[model samples]
Target: MRSDSMGRQLLPKRIALPIFASDALSSVAYAPDEILLTLALAGSLAALNSVWVGVAVAAVLAVVVISYRQTVHAYPSGGGDYEVVSTNLGKTWGLVVASALLVDYILTVAVSVSSGAAYITTALPSLAGHEAIIAVTLIVILATLNLRGTREAGGAFAIPTYLYMGAIALMVVVGVIEWVTGNLGAAPTAHYDLVATGGHEEGLVGLAGAFLLMRAFSSGCAALTGVEAISNGVPMLRRPKSRNAATTLALLGTIAATMMLSVLVLARQTGVKIVENPASQLTLNGQPAPADLQIAPAISQIASAVFGAGSVFFFIITAVTGLILVLAANTAFNGFPTLASVLSRDAFLPRQMYRRGDRLSYSNGIIVLSAAAIVLVLGFNAQVSRLIQLYVVGVFISFTLSQLGMIRHWNRILRTRQSGEQRGRVLRSRAVNVIGFMMTGLVLIIVFITKFAHGAWITLVMILVVFLIQQGIHRHYETIRSQLRVDDWTAKRTLPTRVRALILVSNFSRPSMRAVAVARASQPSAIELVSVVADETEERRIRSEWEESGIPIRLTLLSSPYRNVIQVILQYVRTRRKRSPSEMLVIYMPQFLVRHWWENALHNQMALRLRRALLGVPGVVITVVPWKLGEDAEVEGHQLVNDPFKRPTTIPSPSSDTLVGPETVEE
Candidate 1:
């Protein structure tokens, strides 16, 4: 609700990187947990392959990042996946991509904050019981900060993001050093024996082992969750927006891939053991682990073992990693607004979402994103594991469709541009997108097959609902356009042959007098002071003054037996409209403008209702002549009468009837 200046909203690369890259970078905090948790289902042998799954996921990340870099260059308008699919695949698939990305952004906020809360409870046992509350609090903080503007939020969040990257890098370095120098030891739970569940204790075998590997691979694909955020937010970047965004995407890919793979390998090297049912699947010192024992996340356990538990370096990594996870949702804060703005421009979202706030941010979209994320947090009770099941499905859906759309886009371009280096570039870009689509499509199917019943179905349903809603909005807009279209330029718009100005006289005050003066200046052929006589005493006082003052305009009285001013005015308007539907019926509704918002409630109740009810009458125009309550309402009233801009040109005539009063003047 402030200045929506464009310059203030443009983000330089330094700030934009953090704005869009936070989610991808923060995935290192929890992606490992998911990978380890899923692999641990089949015991240690499957767990040993965690690093391999991470490698496969990182490869997909590489292809996706490359594909999206091409995307930003090709379509710099910030619609990202939605634009690509809509341009090449048609509006329906475009809506599907938008719906998937929209759902993905919401889940990113929920899953990131939930994972952050898990890290908090890991370091501080006292806060374990309030995870959902803590997660929602984090969402509120993020929404508030983001509403301040993208550049400001990026500035505020940049430090922690840098610190998190540094911390993770340091952890990896310290971990490798400890591993090389023979100083690293097993994690706190490394000694706990991991027992295979569902009678697979002997070890993974045959088709079942292959399926377990596939499931772990799908789980690890969570690392790719936030990779598309940079592409979705190209317009937010400074000049050369697409180039800067593509570079940021590359930076994100390198950092996220490096961190995810290193952390997984280190977690595996530290002999970190994780099981979904820790009490039943894990045994410590030859006895079943305590049923209520809290298992720290894989990142936490790795940090502890590598840096030595309780050390300053270890605590710093733990704190910043958690901070990064909370800030990871910042990516969605930037993404959803930009994407929603595009949707709004395309008539798929509310016009309000297209508006930038005084802070030059999409405040409405931010507020809505926060509300939805909070609902998810509350619905899942802030449990990271539960939310994770619903997490990557949306992103993968978007990834699969967006890449396919990009391929179509490049092919369409290749056909248009033949014989040159441009053709070569197009072919290369298409190849990258092809690889990206195939990789992501495979992961999407794997995720669907492995996690569908576990909660991915919920995300699928959500995407369908959003898709339908967007389609409805598009249809509604199309209908409005069809209804409003003009077929001929010479078509006539109706105008009154003779003006009839009805000045509503609520009381004999200066404000009412001003209304009569302006109406007379408008030079209507037929002008009358209309009033509903609620009380005979009030009516008598007005008529006595009317005769004494000798006001030239005729007064028309309507009897309101039920004291219902609005109904009486509506009846009069209806009758007048029926008598002269082709003529302009100008209803001069005078009002007093008060300074404060609450003062509005004190006045204008009748005038407001009169305006609303009379709108149904064809050819009726309600003109509000407002008198400011303080500091010369009468002077401004005369100004309203004489100001050329205030009085309609068609109404002003050379031989208009003059109002005989000190404030009324001949113009």
Candidate 2:
């Protein structure tokens, strides 16, 4: 089906919430695991500090959310950080943020799909070892949904997203009430001590122990992964796009922070324990548990403790949690393409990104994002724990840069509007962005220092690679623009003085006749037909067909011992140019148009190849003469012969010696 227009594609906040907020909501599924796992390395007391670490993350989330709200209001063009940075700082910094966001969006899909797959294995133990395949398949499914346009994909994902929000909120409420009433008991592994190793046996204390806390904080910051999606996707929203986007950002932040804190509290109260290595680090019944013992995720444990294991509530939570995690990738699918579109508009990406596909979605960008996520899935073997280390670096980089850009943006505006109500808002916005930048800058440092050895360096490398690629694309566009610009109007503009047409033909087909009529109707200086001779028998058969057609043009045969039609045409064109070096030579070839893609391979497309070779010849041109299948061949050819005054006229073509050469022209 054909897609709707851009106006029809605009999404209301209700639909946009799922398309953009799913990533932030789904982080609750695994953000708790990261915090608990990272802290569990520092013994039980530090692991018990999960809530405190979450509070720290949530505080930063508040600042960032407020900052982005201001961003959407101030700049509603949907360029997000790239636009902010480009307008405030410079285009170079804009590219840096773009590159970082590109990497972060790809990582969001990779990490989200991987975690979703892990939840699948958690729910179905028999499906173990197939996580990567399941994850890739999920990516393909998400890609398909997104390619169907923005609103369609948003509607498809809305139910599960709202379900996830309700489920998580209910789980948190039920979990808290159960613990308060002493109805929910400790988790299955609540009594198992987290045996510490590598100098963390004495619990968190002193500088050595403080670094572990920072590591956990940095890991917990994964909760903030998709916080900027709303800002990037402001253009896709309905009327009052900025206000709706800002409201969505605020709602995302509030829900996410609440869920994170709720999950953290429930985990703590139910004595849920998550560790990085279940094989060696975990113990049961005062001894090492079975190596194959399935450690339920923190959320799953909380769900189980709140509503008895295998209960309908627990299964519902588990099911929707997995769904939201997979749907989280949909956020990237929506945001990445929009951001890629902005980059394309600025000439930092391919022009393909600027066009919407049949469904009014950025289908090329979606395909490219899916391909990158699949590569990452296969590369990292679909291990969420492993892939997560490479997750937040790029996002925090974007966060820091985006905040800095917004601050600069406000300052620039404030200077322009010296004394007005607008200046007050600009100053307030600058304060928000300032706080956001400082906080995110600290997190970036923590992420780099704590996770660099783990895997964050790989993300930095990716950002650099993407940045360089964007720079390359920018340079290419700049070169093309420079070449197109008229430097010296009189000296630079070279006008063609004469025109001649050469029609290449294999047989007197309809395509050939159409080309002959067009060339004659245009009335070129002269006309000639070119054919490459592979063998006498084949050439004789063509000659017999041409004589029967009764066309006036003389046929010239070029030798092709190698049976290379392109080579024969190029040699003949070069020889003709040498003989008549004045006229602007036009090479026209007849082509049969096929209705099906597979029909292309079935046909021998010699004229197509001949066009490419003849393009390089100086003072020459190429034209396609397409003829439809099942059309009369002789009608147009005979029409051209019958036109009384359609005689080939002679024109005095000027030689290149009369043309001013660059070396002889005045600068």
Predicted structure with the largest TM-score when compared to the true one: 2
Regions of candidate 1 where Cα sits further than 4 Å from its true position:
1-14, 197-212, 238-241, 414-417, 420-425, 479-494, 533-554, 559-564, 593-596, 599-604, 616-618, 630-667
| Residue-level lDDT tens digits of model 1 in 377-483 | 99999988888888888888788898889888887787794878889878888899898889899999999998898899999999999998888888898899897
TM-scores across all candidates? 0.87, 0.88
Against the unseen true structure, what C-alpha lDDT does each candidate score? 0.83, 0.84
lDDT of 2 by residue, 1-667 (tens): 3544788888998898888989998998998899999888877888888999999999999999999898898889988888888888898888888999999999999999998998988899899999999999999999998888788888899999999999988988887788788898778778787878688876678776788889889988999989888888998999889999999998899999999999999899999988766656777677876677778888889888888888999899898999999999999998899999999998999999999898888999999999999999999999999999999998898899999888877777776837777778677778888899999999999999999999989998999999999999989999999988997998756665566677887777667777776676665666666777677686677778766766566666666767877766777788878987877788888778777788999977766767777778887888886766654554344644334224435423223332221111011
Q: How many backbone clashes are present in model 2?
A: 0
Clashing residue pairs for model 2: none
lDDT of 1: 0.83
